[model samples]
Target: MARSGNVWSRAGVALFQLAEYLHEPGASVGYTLANWNISFGGSVAMGAHRSSLREPSMVAAGVLAVDIIDGNGNIRHIQRDESSDEWLADSCPSGITTCTV
Candidate 1:
């Protein structure tokens, strides 16, 4: 996981831990799962949602970019706005990774 400015990034981490780290006055994750023990990668794979009904379950909605390792062991960084639909759908939601956060 990495923290750059207000854009928090994660590959594998506990949801509660992430929440704790982001917890502070005026600092929040915006959307989170009710089950704190769930891992970030797992949640993304499961398409987990926040407790609020207004929020959607597509966790990728909050993600700005993702670092993925291809089958050939290549680290490919994909940005939300600049990436293709196929790349985003295949990499972000699957939680398939051969690289560390």
Candidate 2:
């Protein structure tokens, strides 16, 4: 009985940490806002009820990186020139790995 409570307590703490990290703008490519226009967000919910057996829950985590665009067109792994604004990125919100509202 005590062991079960410990497990859920850890899960709850992890959920809170993840929520805080998501609030940040995005992962820093250069540790600055030059190319820090990435999007990373999701919803997390947890509820507890009286039960003898523990129910499994699904948790998913993934990266939301920018799709690069060189002078020609959309491509993978195109280096961005932070000094000049010529480099481009896809309109991030619409472009996601497998994002959902």
Residue-by-residue lDDT tens digits, candidate 1, 1-101: 43435545566688777777777434555567546787766776666766556755566566666676666777877666635764456544544442333
Where does model 1 exceed 4 Å of error?
1-5, 51-56, 95-101
Per-residue lDDT tens digits for candidate 2, residues 3-95, read 211011222233344334544644211111111222222221111111223322212112123244344664544233534232222222232
lDDT of 1 at 82: 36
Q: Model 1, 22: alpha-carbon shift in Å?
A: 0.8
Best by TM-score: 1
Cα RMSD (angstroms) for every candidate in the order listed: 5.4, 17.6
What value does the lDDT take at residue 20 in candidate 2?
49
Residue 2's lDDT in candidate 1: 39
Query: Number of clashes in every candidate structure?
Result: 0, 0
Instruction: Point to the candidate with the largest lDDT.
Output: 1
* Candidate 2 local lDDT, residue 48: 17
